[model samples]
Each structure stands twice: as structure tokens, then as C-alpha cells.
Target: MQEITDETELRELIGEPLPRAWEKERTSLHELDRAWLAASPFCLLATAGADGSCDVSPKGDPAGYTLVLDEGTIAIPERPGNRRVDSLRNILTNPHVGSIHLIPGRGDTLRINGRARLVRDAPFFDDMVVKGHRPVLAIVVEVEQVFHHCSKAFLRSQLWQPETWAPQAVPPRAVLAQTLERPDATLSDLEDYYGPSYADGLYRGQ
Candidate 1:
């Protein structure tokens, strides 16, 4: 097997894209693009660190949780999590980010490539509050290019089909602790620990 190292060789192998596919990308959000973002409850955010290492993280909430501030700007609230802040930290060093928005039962996805910055403005942060908990920060994206990605991937994977899903139950905390070799933990204690996090923000930092 030989490695393809240059764009010319790769492009020659794949050939030119269809005209409509090439022309579908827009500099700003269009009506349909806005609609897609409004209906999509989940998206994957991709970022690269200064060291060139990359990471992709999942962001999700209710439908339209990601706000379209205008045709050229989007605001995404950062929910509380493990607090590693890999994406947020990457944005600080490198403003470039790519996000793919997905809607259940929809074959086509929305892709956005742009520069991002973290924000903590008062009223903006207040607007993102859920269950009396506001995020410590939000990400503002300057729209550069947006497009409706094709459906072949979703069609092949049948991601939205319930019949294709795996049936697996979450193990009890005692079992989980034992698997991790934590001797003194109980299922009740684990439940008690995780229960409050769902209602109360896990990381409430500014």
C-alpha cells in the first residue's frame, strides 16, 4: 500500500465534487440553516490545541439550545461537566472550531466552520440558565462557512433507528466500584453522589 501525501494526488483520486455540493456552502446562516440549528439538540465541537492535538466534545440540550444571535453569529452555552474544559481551553489558544449539528430522524446534518471565543457577559450568561443554574461561560462563533452535509453517513449507520440500537443496562455502583477496585463504595452512595449533579450544576465556577 502506498501513502497519498499531497492534495493534488488525493484530489485526482476523488475527482471534483458535484457542482451543487460545492455551491451549497454559505458564508452566513440561511433560513434552512437556521431551522436546522433550531431543531438540532446535539452537536459535536472540534478544536485543536496549540500543540496541534485535536479533540471533539459533544454538546447537547433541548432543541434550539444553541442560539443564533444573527445571520453571522451563534451563541452556545457551555454546560457543566467534568471541568477539563478541553474545547474551551483550545478555543483560547486557537480560535478555530468546527461543529456538526445533528437532528434525530434527519438524514442530513448541518456543519459550521468558524472562529470561536469564550464569553461571560451578564445578560448573555443569564439567558442560558437552566434549572436556576447558569453556565460559567458561553462560546460565540463568528460564522465563516456553513452547509447542510449529505445524508449517506446517517443512512449507512441507521443512527436514528430504535431497532438498531444496543440494549445494555447501566451496572450498579457497587459493581462499577468493584470493577474499578474501589473497595468501600456502595451503590447507594454512588447514587447519592450523582443524583444532585443532574439538578445542581456539577461545576459552578466563573
Candidate 2:
């Protein structure tokens, strides 16, 4: 095995940039971009720790949970999830973060690079509440760069193709609860508890 230690060798191995439409088509975020971000119900958050360890987590809600505060700032409400807080921990240790927001059946994705801070104020939470749910903590990001990611990945994966979609047969919540040591729980019990109160619990701070 040979290792290339020189810039000449490295450039030869990787070659020059390929011709890409996106390379010449870069655009800044405008009102339309904000509208798109507001309509997206999901996003992928990427963060890195002080030691360079990285984590990417998915966040979602009905829609508009992520707010475009301005051309250079955005706020994402932290909804209920597994509670691991990998992304939050990384942000606390290292302020840099990246995010990609996606809307189902939509080709354009909003990509943002920013610095993140955890906000726990009541007014911020009050502004985020939807359907009577409020997030306890929100991630406020000061955007450094914002751009649109083209649709190649979605096209390649056929993500929005109806025929390619799979049925939703995820395991019953009770099974997971039981595995986690809640032995006496039932699906109905879990659903009854979650269905009625989950929205409120998740949007508590909002």
C-alpha cells in the first residue's frame, strides 16, 4: 500500500472539480427560502464535540416548528424524543452545528451552518407552542451560511415515490416498554397515555 504525502500526489489522486450545475447556481436565502423552512416538518441536525466527535440526529414536528427568525438566524423547538440529547451535548461542548431541513415530496433542502445556543426562556417557548404543546428547551442558531441542497439524493433514492414506500408496521410501543422493563404495560395503555398527552408534554415550554 502506498501513501501520498505530497500535495501534487493528493491532487492527482482526487483530480479537479467536476462540472456541476449547482456550482454555478448557488443562491442565498430569501423570503421564499424562509417560507420553505417554515413549511418543513423535519430536519437533520449535525453537531461536533470539542474532541471532534460528531453526531447527526433527526428532529420533526407537524410543520413550522423551525422558525426563521431572520436571514441570519433560526430557531428549532426541541420536541420529545429518545432523551439521549447527543446533539445538544455536542453543541454545549462545541458551538458549531449544521442542519438540513427537508419537506416530504420536495426536492429542495435547506442546509445551514451555524453556531447554536440552548434557550430556556418562557417567552421563547411560548412563541413555539403549537396545538397546545411547548418545547422545554429550544435551540437558537445564528446562521453563518445557508444554501439549498439539490435533489440528487432524493431522486436517486426515490424517496417520494409512492411505489417505493414501505408499510408502517413498526413494533407496538408496549413491546418496547416491556423490553425496557415496563413488564405490565399494554399497547392500549401506552397509546392512551401518549396520544392524549404527548402533544402537551412535548410543547410544554412553547
TM-score per candidate: 0.84, 0.74
Ten contiguous residues with the weakest lDDT in model 1? 197-206
lDDT of 2 by residue, 79-151 (tens): 7677789999998999999899999999778888889999876466777877776777899999877778789
CA displacement after TM-score superposition, residue 63 of candidate 2 (Å): 1.8
What's the lDDT for candidate 1?
A: 0.86
Candidate 1 local lDDT, 88-193, one digit each (tens): 9999999999999999899989999999999987576766776677777799999999998888998899888899877556776556765686657776766676
Give the count of colliding residue pairs in each prediction: 0, 8
Model 1 root-mean-square deviation: 3.3
